[model samples]
Target: MSSKFAQNRSFKKNCTAFAAFFIMSVSYCQTSTYGQFWNEVQFNRTINAKWSTELNLGSSYSSTETSSNIFENNIQKSFRGWGHYYLSPRWKISSFVAYYDNKDVPEIGQFKSPEWRFALQAIYYFHKTGYTLSTRMRMELRHMRNGDDDYENVLRYRQQFKYLQPINSKILRKGVVYGIASDELYFKSGTKVTGLSFFDRNRLVVGAGYLFTDDIQLEFAYANEYLPRDNENQIVNAASLTLTFNNLLPNLNKKLLHKNEANTNED
Candidate 1:
């Protein structure tokens, strides 16, 4: 038991050191910087006993420095939605589709058709610190407007960790404030891609959230993304505001019903 515990400690120490290095490099060691502000609204809700769904809407404003003009302006508009089906106690499957409209991007050009992606993912859930930690593995296929005659092919692998720590102990109450942190590292492989490093980018975000009952949530966060290029590494700084509403129509119906009941009582 002593030997096992020692090994676990060593492993955790190494992992923590690596994560710190990655985050520091991204936030401080990049060039040709940009600023991005984003807004997102998302929902995740359970359906029946074995299914769930997610809906997301988001947009962004970005500006980068270039010699041709003082600073190039860009905006991104997007939507993402997915559905989940539980297959067992610890495993599930998800299908997701997303759309993006980005301006002044090198990959998609200044003005062109929007980009689209479809993905299928498998998720495994585990318990840690009395909370759930999810490991999601996904594969995506993409379609975009490009000069190439064939579609772009890329494979990505990402690992994300999320945790919510409650500030209130009352189970019957309708509100709770929690802190959350998530980190994701990305890699890509494809036919038309060329890069010196197989590991491309890293993203880290930390923030607090407020949950009002089971219907709504609000979160604000700061995010940093590292992009590797041939000449230099680039860093994009972002601030985000997110609002999530679960079962929108159902929640509205419940409010209306309560209002009608109050009127009947008065009569």
Candidate 2:
């Protein structure tokens, strides 16, 4: 297990180095939409027979449109705290609150416009495996505050439908695993000068992981996203790695069996 995990770490480091070199060598024109790159620290704790909680914290830095002529480096920090309720064997309900920021770093004395989004999600499981279908509705409030510019209340609605399928090993003990996901995002309020009038953003991600033990899984992924507006479109390519430690590993097997029995009884 340790050897497999070490190999996975080596792979992640190599991928990160390649991505960094590729981006620095080229000059990107137009707008770039980068997917989140920070490592995720997530743990799941079962509270009772029907309730569970997930906590996550992550951060990322990327390049974005600075102004009309230049580009500014952007950084985003995301913290997520969510709860899941098992309504039935195949049905579940989850909700999360996320904070996002779009900051301008080049301009002197420039402030940041942070956005807060609250989302309620519903998920349906296919079987004992990880195959699932998810629908999410997010209500967003963007507070655009700057030292030089004053903007009004930005209210937006975002809805997404996603499908998740496992691409790696099915056995948890083997450690090497992958999940492929795709989603379509719809935006209501147009952004500032980017001239975005209701765009379609589609994302494809491949998550690869190697488990060190029942308690720890080290993961890496390559993701791409395309957002097309009326005339202009933004393209993004991002790579990231995460190390997940399952604090409640001793209970996972018991819970898995319980979850399986629940599904069987429902069936």
Candidate 3:
């Protein structure tokens, strides 16, 4: 009876959070809003008990109400690589470098220059019986060439709160479906940011994921973005999809070697 009651409480809490996120997203549509779609593919490899790495490639597309097709315009393409070290089961630290080819501005011409970014991140996890909560703090250094062909540098800080709950089991594992939600805030500081506000933007996401196997998973989510500018604020309603592969190459190689050994024995 106690377990059943707890499950009911968890469900209610999740429903409430989802409802609030949906309402906020709807309210943002009253402003200068646009629609976007982001797709990403990630590869993860575990090097040892304390070390891991990830590579991610992603693209973004944008559309306005008058646009004929939502995906007709490609706004951004990016690649990022990360190296992680585990301090313990509950803490992790990482560093990453990223490159972005941005074509979102018509005034600047398409893909005229690119952005380079580097970040350091730390995460702390709170483990509960049925769910996990975490916070991530990241600091970023961004470099890009301005219209005058001079290099501009900016510093940004980001903080995010994330929650994960397993639907079918006590813990997240292979073949389990899970619910996830996160909210992130961004802040900017630098000489180039003199005219802009210190508060950069906010991103909120609500999503679900299905673990197909130990090596692969897929996630789909709705993301709401609010960015404040000097003249007009921008709102983005985005759909995001991510596919993750774990130890893909190593697993495939192992299977191939096993098959070859079997063939040799048969001969």
Candidate 4:
């Protein structure tokens, strides 16, 4: 009952945040300044020593105005499930199925985009020292529907490279930092579209994370983005706090109690 209540509260909180985001976005539609906020709730489990499954729920809201009279706002909500399989100790393959919706206008708002994404990744690890080189190739199946218009399906691809380095190891041990660079390419292949052209989007991401224990972790990340559709570059700031459980959730203070008992036995 307590767990159910807690989940209900969290759902309500997320809804409230989404509502606030919409309000703020609409209100700032006529200004040059823009703001966006996003949140993600993720869960993952190891399917085997080399395979894993991950689930993610994410929401975002953003607003911008090209001029005093022209305003644009965006709201997105997505849920994704993915499977990751390691080909080698430092190389992996990933496939994902996702359902996403974008809200563009207030009157007849909502565009559905269900996509399937696949990726291959390579990671190079340094001996003893905490560092890694990461590279990836990504492809996606994009289904887009706008208002009453017929849906269109398309294919998109991206290539990315990143460097991961350890930052701090005390208190929050396993602290690491990353520098990422990515380029996105789109392929227009469908029955409903005319001219086919490639659009490129670039991003830079930097972040740090810590492993509190084997079962718990926290991370914060920030990104800068450039999209071909928008004339002005955008900046994104993000933060996350995650809790990972191996089998089931454990009581946080159980280790302290066990340590006390062991000391008593020793005395």
Q: Which candidate is the best by TM-score?
A: 3
Residues 1-267 of candidate 4 have per-residue lDDT tens digits of 999999999999999999999997666543233345556767777777898888877776554444222223446777888788887776678888887766652212334433334333343433245555566677777666644566666676666666655555312243333332333333434333212335534656666555655555555556555433222223333232334343222343676778999999999
Candidate 1 lDDT, 105-186, residue by residue in tens: 5323345446687888887877555345667677776565444434565566666666555566432125877666777777
lDDT top scorer: 3
| C-alpha lDDT values of all predictions | 0.72, 0.62, 0.85, 0.54
Off by over 4 Å in 1: 1-30, 66-74, 88-92, 106-113, 129-132, 147-151, 170-173, 191-197
Number of the candidate with higher lDDT, 1 or 2: 1
* Consecutive 10-residue window with the lowest summed lDDT within model 4: 229-238
Instruction: Report RMSD for candidate 4.
Output: 19.1
Q: Which pairs of residues collide in candidate 2?
A: none
Ranking by lDDT: 3, 1, 2, 4
* Candidate 2 ranges with C-alpha deviation above 4 Å: 1-36, 64-74, 105-111, 128-176, 191-196, 229-232, 248-267
| Model 2 residue 84 lDDT score | 89
- Per-residue lDDT over 206-259 for candidate 3, one digit per residue giving the tens place of the 0 to 100 score: 999999987899999999998776555678888999999999999999999999
Error of 4 at 20 (Å): 43
RMSD per candidate (Å) reads 12.9, 18.0, 14.8, 19.1
RMSD of 2: 18.0
